[model samples]
Target: MGRNTRKRRTPLATKAIAASAALALGGGGLIWANFYASAHESNSGQNQTKAAAGQVATISCPDVGQKLTNVPQRARRAVAKELANLDKQITEAYARLASTRQAQTRDANFVQNSIVGPLKEKRAASLDRIRLDIQRVGGRVNTSGLGSLAPCTTQPADQTNAGGGQNGNGGQQQGGDQQNGDGQQQGGGDQQQGGDAGQNIGGQAGNGPVAADFVDITKVAANVQGKPQNGGQASTGSFTTKCGVNANKNHNTDNVIVAPGVTNGAHHLHDYVGNQKVDAFATNDSLIQDQTSCQNQGDLSAYYWPVVRVQDGTQDFDQNADGGGKEGNVGKILTPVQAEIKYVGNPQSKVVAMPQFLRIITGDAKTTTNGLANANAHWSCTGFEDKVQLTEQYPICPQGSNVVRTFAFQSCWDGQNIDSANHRTHVAFADPASGACGNGFKAIPQLTMRLVYEITPPTLENGQVKNAYAVDGFPEQLHKPATDHDDFIAVFKNNLANKIANCINAGKQCQ
Candidate 1:
């Protein structure tokens, strides 16, 4: 049987058909069927051609069923692999989205708690530092032998103040509980007083020094061709006065009045040398208590004053009064920028105006350094007549006079009976709890917002003048404050609300 067996040959025509079918259908059965067709064709001329065709057809019949099963199996495997890939891609995309959302939330929360919250707290602390530093400087005696002292210009960096700057006098302590209800229990009329000789009035009891030749806007008539200069002292046309009416009218929108004694004290420029101590101002008189009253220092001239407003049964001129409202009477303080604007008048006016600069000086040093030494060393004061080399670092009063202390001043604190320890609590004058926001201390977040906005757009709607961001809303006079602190609290709250909304709308811009 092996010797008789011959190899089966594939016909060309059948092979061509099977190869074509395989190329089109991609199945082994199709290729085999073509081969069978070719084999039947090859046997065509013989007597068994018809029988061969029948046998070839029968031989390829089973291939069709096998191809159907194999095609379906391959398709199922490919579909399963494709489905698995889709699921993995979907999972990764979802995870990435979730992570992005979480990161955004964390960032938003950090800005709110770390940046905004800390800013608010620092604003309060800064106000305290200003007041404390002023008190420390005022406590010294005029060792420089000049009638007037000078404002402190060299403010130590915050980091250097590890101790309370000078003899435990510049640190903050936990205050006691505050009073409830509107701090303005009584809204009686405060008796008006006169300004010292040459003082610029910031508050009612203007503790800051003054000069008579500083020029008065109201007194200088528009029709007058040539205005008097320095009260006709020299070639300078500066005319200064301690006019309470003009000063009051200047900062009336602030709801604060300016009087003599504080800003209008006796002005006699003197120098504070290093390594010396000056006598502290009299505690009995609130007007001359702080260096804030000093008119000149180096390139900087500070005009210090005490704010007076309604409080409880009595009236207070100094801003140290507390316990006039709930939540411990957090009184808000005005910033240096705001204060400068009120005292210096409009910057756009044709009249020559001084620069609006506010520098907050604070430190904690156990021993006195160069700047922390006596008031004489703290600053050097010069006047227009002094033939001294006008050093930019030395303090100079535009007018060569001190803001005089007057007895009849209405806004001055009743310091005749009160001492330093008790004068702060005598009466509610500038209660932080009833000031700009709702606290007496200054709120920095609100202040920053206000300043930034104003610098961008100096003009606001209506005839209202924008002073400080100490308040929240764009307009400063909207809130109905029961206490001084409410004004500032309202502003702070408004600013925060706006910031939050912006963050939500603009994604990361709020930070």
Candidate 2:
């Protein structure tokens, strides 16, 4: 007779116990699972499960092992239901802790003493009950592993605080360097200055924390104006370009670089469109050579920045004030539900060729701290153009309308420089009234992007929406509703730029 070929009934709980042992022995596991447990100490000098006065306590567990194939369907469902309840309880605890804010120092104490301590005790009791349930089902429980919880001791502000570094435009180029097809730097050299705009302030490399002193220019109401209407004449011609959705698949990974040698991609995620191969190390030549997601094959520009997330009150994104110190623990990334790109120009004048490799940042991403700069960042309801607001808090759209994020790039460019020491000096916004180019500035094909989201309007409770929508931002930002920002780069080929110019000046609408 053939050897019995039946599979053993290995319970999921047993496998989980074995996996926990394997992880302990190898010291190679998902760090985020027990990140706070090992890295942070409680005020009590005990494990993270016990806090003294003002500390953050955390509960964590290794992931359950591989799914049990031999388990009966009904039993599996029961296990899932129990696990979900536990998760919900933990999420509620976190929300309660987040809502209780006093003075920063006092708040820490209240959280550690009142919130974390009670939650830890409650979790321990729940785990004991779960162990009994698993045992009754013929499953072995890892009591020690399930009981693991930790408390985080509060450190001094200067010691534990994280801050973003100011970005300088100067750097030496490495590797085989050459100019791109558009005569822009392919590699090696300090960041070139396009005009006299000064060094790019707040241009920190990578996804680092925003500088505490950083100011957002967009929030300044004085700097912003209503959208300009056609200035000199009607458009002679126009061309429409359709770009594909955000393309950075590994945006959640911290390994991606935003600038050379800067590993800032992982702290916050960005939505990249245009170049399919953009990363921290992408170069002008590499971008030009790569395929674009845009329908206009000739248009090869890259646009990206931190993405936004809608806070519907039920989700726990780990959006702590200290910029969650743990790696890979950044909040979730939400893709844009819809995106539109368009270029417009004056009917009387030809749209001039944009300088190669020109960098433009429209909205300030760090607007949560500096409210004045928000003036330049535009937010509005789809049908309520008259209701535009400069505040970071997104307005609830009227019935039948959608939330709109509009970004209009500076249309005037210095003829010579592609970029300046500060990214802005090379490009200046057109005059608001006449839509006329500034002195010594030539008009280029105007770039504008509108992003629409289908997020439901958050209901106001006690004069505040508990979990209103928010854009992705530095960890220290607390995911404030006002911290939206966007970036753009001009990589148009000489021929394509001329074509766009011809179409606009000729009064022809060509897609």
Q: Using TM-score, give the best candidate's number.
A: 2
Query: lDDT score of model 2?
Result: 0.42
Cα lDDT of model 1 by residue, 1-511, tens digit: 0011111211422333233334323522221211111111111211000111111010000111111111122232232222222222222222222123224244645323533344334333433332343335443222332111111111111211111111111000100001100112111112111111111111111100011101111111111011112211111111111212212211211100111112211111111211011112222122122232112211112222222221111222222222111101112322222121111111111121211221111111111111221110011111211111110011112333221111000011222211112112211211111112112221111111101011111111121111111111100011101001111111111243234323322223222
- TM-score each candidate: 0.15, 0.53
Candidate 2 residue 180 Cα shift, in angstroms, is 34
The alpha-carbon RMSD values of the candidates against the true structure, listed in the order shown, are 43.6, 24.5
List per-prediction Cα lDDT, in the order shown.
0.18, 0.42
Which sections of candidate 1 miss by over 4 Å?
Answer: 1-106, 116-424, 427-511
Q: Distance (Å) between predicted and true CA of 440, model 1?
A: 25
> What residue runs in model 2 are displaced by over 4 Å at the alpha carbon?
1-236, 247-258, 313-332, 347-349, 370-375, 386-389, 480-482
Number of clashes in model 2?
31
Lowest lDDT sum, 10 consecutive residues, model 2, at 169-178
Highest lDDT against the true fold, candidate: 2
**Candidate 1 residue-pair clash tally:** 92
